[model samples]
Target: MAEGGEDPQRLKKIAAAAYDYDNDSRWTDYWSNILIPPHMASHAEVVEHYKRKFYQRYMDPDLVVEPMSSTSSSQSARPSASTTNANEQQARSRSSGSVPRTAGPSATTGAANPSSVRWDQQTIQFSVNAWVFVIAVLAVLPLVPKNLSNRAYRLSFMGTACSSLYSLYALYGRPRAWNMQGMQVYFQSIVGAKDFIYFIYCLTFVTSNLCLKFALIPILCRALEQVAKFLRRNFTRSTIYRKYLEDPCVWVESNTTTLNILSSQAEIAIGFLLIISLLSWQRNFIQTFMYWQLLKLMYQAPVTAGYHQSNWSKIGRTVNPMIQRYAPFLNTPVTAVQRWWFR
Candidate 1:
């Protein structure tokens, strides 16, 4: 103790704190390794300045509003006592270039993540939108006139593709769900969010091109009925997926018994029209297109089955490189461009 029970060591630390505040060189180094919080055990003034400023900029103000009094008609003209005191203190600290020795819990708690919570809400809504879209397409497709069903189906496919792509982009760019990693593994990643049933439903859109044979349409509907059952069982209970699957209007339910016959008939008619368009020369194009669609499905099947992107990449590495070499030339749009030049 130096004098009157004052500790000599604390005086030295207080001096060091002043030294730290004035010296820009040490302060720069202090910030370069900023992740390591300052040694405030000695009541570092330099650290305190920053800590107060941090709260001023980022802290949510704890406003205390008392019940209004009818006697005070000029209430709006005067600020609250707390606010006035806070402002006065803030001004004094700024003028003196010294922060008060207040290291309250609010200063250390940092900021709350309102944006993160909002994004989670957005992700839930996006999933709900996708679910609603597919259901709408299914319910309305049976009623669509045969003459316009082709265009209507194509529009439905395009709409779904856009929605899927948007969801994927949004999901990948930022993480929202606590258990989920990225959209690449969203539906299938058991280690992440096990939402595989939605992935299967998305695939059915791509496969609708193969909607041939009216008699087998009933069987396909039956299989999708099972898909609905599986989705309800596996996904409806989980917190992340329940918002999408179990929501009142968005809940995916179809009368498989009644709908199957109508759905099958629609498919038969669609198949007949498609078959009538297959000219002799177009047979090769049809075959090639089918092969292309199958190839695409092969690439996606593993992902749909729940493997992560890393695993799928490794699994396809052998064949993918070879296919890549010739894919550009064989691709339909590229070939069409080459043909147009000669014609």
Candidate 2:
């Protein structure tokens, strides 16, 4: 073969060798040692290298050498070329319209999933229980005696009063955090603001129901106890109808026992509400404090020195004043009578 004829073969061999060398070195040091630095060195140099490399590898050399008649080739290759081009176009269109696939259900079943469901169920059950408590308290109200001692009345009232206060606290204790002027701010500076607020709401709802339940019931129960005490006093004094009211032991015993049970129920309801409220408040305070700490960290940290503090000062300043105005409502008195009425 002529020297000129062997030129293309020799050039192809040289290109293949260079490609192999670059490809092998690519997995190790070639990218960091050569390509990356060149690209970072100068935009113009990078662009020139990219263009040269792209053309050398991708451009058809045969097109340059054999610039012949379009008519002759078109006649022979028309059908096959058209079919290939159509297939390529269809593949590209299909790929362009294809939607992406995701991972399995496990991806969505994190801590929040079951917790959210449980909360929902609890809320529903509690709502039903609250209504039942209210009905029970009401049913026992008219049976209480008016002449009962102050201590018995007070005990009954304490339960309902606490529930009312707890309900009120839950209703308005914590405001939702507002995201304003690109800053996230809590209404209350305490921890777990959201959870506390939710707990308070639930507790308040339950307590309110309890108050409605016991308000009349306890008063009536006290009255019954007073009647039994009066009957027992007369039974000891009289001799004629002594046998009729003589079972003072049974009447007195049952009345006192029933009163004790009702009073205990009231106490339990109040104590439970108070405990939940405290827990909610504690959780909210911790979460709020933590969020504030995080905000402070973001602001004070050296890494964030250049970060801008947005115009949230105006809104922040109003928060304290708002709390002050609502303080009276928040601190409203909870009387023993009111509490007993609820229980």
Candidate 3:
């Protein structure tokens, strides 16, 4: 290996691993688990520090790296000549499509080419989920006028369904082959995927005649979780974020399990609500049947099975004895539902 110049062999290996974006190898999985704190990771200097090191190591061996302190911003009014030259070189490389670009300075620069400014699917998902969370909150607030609240509620689910579908496609592409076996496998994979389930769950109520506000609980929690992640990763440096949003974001990030549990509880309760709704004038038999099937998927899916199963077990313990003592005649029907649930 060369000590003072780019080594093609080493560069080739690194580029292969880095650019193998579609497949997750052990190397990728290992780095994915080692997370940086969002507050620190969001800073421009921190990102530049790593970028400078990467360039020095592989892109330009002679690149002079600057050591920036927390107070470095106050000490400089203009970049040094070396830094200016490096930025120009980077811009040229980007324009020539010779370098990989991220969603950073180059993405916003006026001279950046189309490829340099293209946003990744995760960024698109984040943007969509952020709006979903905002609109979901507005939909629930009583102070909002009824017409506005209705519009907000409808829009929130639409946004959530769109984001969920896009995420599903990003994670797993369309069926590669179109034969009967290939189509069966593709549809099975989609059914078992967590994101697809979410898509279906949100879409179920999108055009329904019944306005079941409880259905919003899962969408609200899921949107809040994703939006909090994006905000923490992108907005830690903003004055408004530091003053008003930091603590809440921190809390949401830390209490993800709590949020998931709350969502699961709301979802289980919603099944009972649907059953009760069947007796009311607002009944939609198709919606009730569809939601229960979705619930069954939530119970069976590996990602959500634990939360939903725990809630289901607790409900059984509470309700079984009540049926035995107070309403033994209802015992047969409850047993029938239990059989269907397990099947």
lDDT of 3 at 223: 92
Query: Which residue runs does candidate 2 get wrong by more than 4 Å?
Result: 1-211, 215-218, 235-245, 254-258, 273-343
lDDT of 1 by residue, 1-343 (tens): 1346676445644543344334333234223433322332233443454433332222211112122243332355244433433444444344323453342356232123333543564455455445544544553467766646555444444444454444343332222243545333333322121122233333444455443323233223433443454455456668766765554323334354344444434433433344454663333345334433432333344322222233335634854565568675445664574355234
TM-score: model 3 vs. ground truth: 0.65
Error of 3 at 133 (Å): 1.2
Q: Is candidate 1 or candidate 3 better by TM-score?
A: 3
The top-ranked prediction according to TM-score is 3
| TM-score, every prediction | 0.28, 0.19, 0.65
Off by over 4 Å in 3: 1-119
Query: What local lDDT does model 2 show for residue 52?
Result: 35
**Pairs that clash in candidate 3:** none
Best of the two (2, 3) by lDDT: 3
Q: Give the TM-score of candidate 2.
A: 0.19
As a whole number from 0 to 100, the lDDT of residue 161 in candidate 2 is 39
Error of 2 at 38 (Å): 99
How big is the positional error of residue 280 in model 2, measured in Å on the Cα after superposition? 15
